[model samples]
Target: MGGVNCLRSLVVLAIVCLMTLFVAQRHKGLTFYKIDAPVLIAHGGGGLPEATTSNSLEALQRSKAVGFCLIEVDFDLSNDEVQLDRKMKDGSPILRDDLSNLTPMTLADLVAWMAKNPTIRIVTDTKDSNEKLIARLSQTGLKEQLIVQVYQADQYQIARNAGFDTIILTLYQSTMSDDEILEFAKANRPFAVTIPRKRATNGNLPERLHEEGVQVLINTINDVWEGKAFLKRGISGFYSDTLMPKGTSSC
Candidate 1:
């Protein structure tokens, strides 16, 4: 019985790897599974309940126990990229993604945490504008698990060239027109296009996304209705905060 079960598991694993590799050919070398289910992907370093732990093992374990294999997390860069989002004292963009200088954990800290939790997959956000740290992260052994999300097309291309893809390029708030969005997909085939749940109003985005050969994933939805609505809207996937555990009401 054990042998049979092991064989079955191996077959499934092989299939998953093949599918991942197939999708990854365009987005550098990282393969992503297009999970169509309404995903309760938690953010913060750790999973929920211990999300405040900031990438601690307890938070990861909680996410695991909650049956969340997919989630979002941040990787603080070593060097700060001074932009203009939240300017510093001098009115500069806060280059403070990782808090190695201000906060406790550094880049090394996040890498160490990733090593401890191998089962969890993450859509890694740069938080600021540091491609160097992202480049370094692409070289990790667990590189396949990381989805490099960049808003800038130039940065996206840079990361794509680095052999660490699984990417989701953030669309500017309500700026992507359907034709533009379709064009974007044609240019970046197979990689996911991340859209806000509220902005996924065009009933044709899903069809066009499929026709354009790009995956569709919505983000940051917290309400149960939103989750269900996105699923019904034909979104390829979505992120959530509730972190639904197994046997819990999907409601």
Candidate 2:
């Protein structure tokens, strides 16, 4: 009986060591992306008030000031030449889809701003071709700070081929099975995947993704209760309008 008990203890110790090795390997795989988990990414630069509308320079600045290190901004081409958020009634360029007092900023403008604010990273929400977008960004020498959000597998490949180190495949409109999504992540090896908060809670998607060391980021979380709920569900981070209410802790 004494011998048997000693053998059982040895087995348990071996199993614990193996589990620790596995976890360390998984963490090393994620280290290539260089992102801190449970991050707060501002949606359209925090989607702040009229003085700092979405996708505007003011919005980006305000987001950084309020303790956000990552900001998502929209990008689209104007006449297939210049990159602008949208065009107004008079065909004047603007930073957001809705017309506002904030002036439109081109890709160059944003990159130059980022050069001055190196601590901030920008997530490019672009439906246009990655080749064109990358070409434009490369001119500014700030492409390393970009995280491209793509919809299609081909776009993911394009971003990778264009030498982007960080890429996210958005699953907001995906109807694929959980297995399919896992396979897609396995093949593409994106830095993260973004899904609507509703779908993020429905299945075992988050757990499966976590097992593979891929981070799961949910979109459009504006309140603290919902943010905490998702974080409790093992979500890696959020695309949020506000980081969290003042004096509130995300942990």
Candidate 3:
């Protein structure tokens, strides 16, 4: 009788554990594992001295060569055309070192590259027109390879509905208070939330988000030790210009 009771207790415990996992999975957006996994996302294809141009194809190649699987690209909408340009200070994203001329990549160019490199996933960032961009990328049939970053809380569902199962809610552009942000995160539960490095260091948002089963990523981290410190404070990953994972070297 004692043995039978012990077996029953084990079975009950297993059932509870499975239920907890199911709830957590349901709360997270689609492709939970993809976003929740701790990864070093190369910012602007990484910061190699020769290939430091932001969002350039050459930089992307260098980052890939360094064994980075996740890469972030910034896009801007101009005249109804999507182009890769993080900052348009000189009306040009970057000047080509080889050509000594300003050249930027188009959406079509990125799509073609993504088709060829199926293993590398892209994280998209834009100040505006995020839904439009998400819709456009979804139409390319590479939804699985794209991770959409929405600046607004309401844009979360819009992105998810656009066939982008993996969506990250980036908070840099938001005006919501920390409590409001936490409330929305608890309600909608995006795959992850990326905060500025200042926010991650100065507040308890990272720990609070982690408690809600939401992964947190900090941006523009260039130092590995800084990344390590945030990881200890509940940050799951970082968007870094040059910080690569252990065993990976940047060229």
Regions of candidate 1 where Cα sits further than 4 Å from its true position: 1-40, 46-57, 78-104, 172-176, 202-204, 211-213, 245-251
Encode model 1's per-residue lDDT on 1-251: one tens digit a residue: 99999999999999999999877763442111222364445555432331232444444555566566665665544336321122344532232354222233344544566677676666666555547756677667777767777665566677778887677766643365778777766887736887765566645676678665577777665555666666676666666554353354232
**Shift of residue 46 alpha carbon in model 2, Å:** 1.7
lDDT of 2 by residue, 18-96 (tens): 9999998854422111123367787776555443225777777667666677888877765665454664445455544
Q: Model 3 off-target regions past 4 Å?
A: 1-37, 51-53, 86-103, 248-251
* Candidate 1 vs 3: which has more lDDT: 3
Q: Please write out the lDDT profile of model 3 over residues 1-251, one tens digit for every residue.
A: 99999999999999999999998875442220112226778886555553443687776776787677888988877656677864334444444454243345678888999998988899998865887888788888889898889898888889877778888888889887889888988988777888998988899998999999888999877766677788878788988765666664331
In order of appearance, the predictions have TM-scores of 0.63, 0.74, 0.76
- Arrange candidates by lDDT, highest first: which order? 3, 2, 1
Instruction: Provide backbone clash counts, one per model.
Output: 2, 0, 0
Best of the two (1, 2) by TM-score: 2
Sort by TM-score, best first: what order?
3, 2, 1
Question: lDDT per model, in order?
Answer: 0.58, 0.71, 0.76
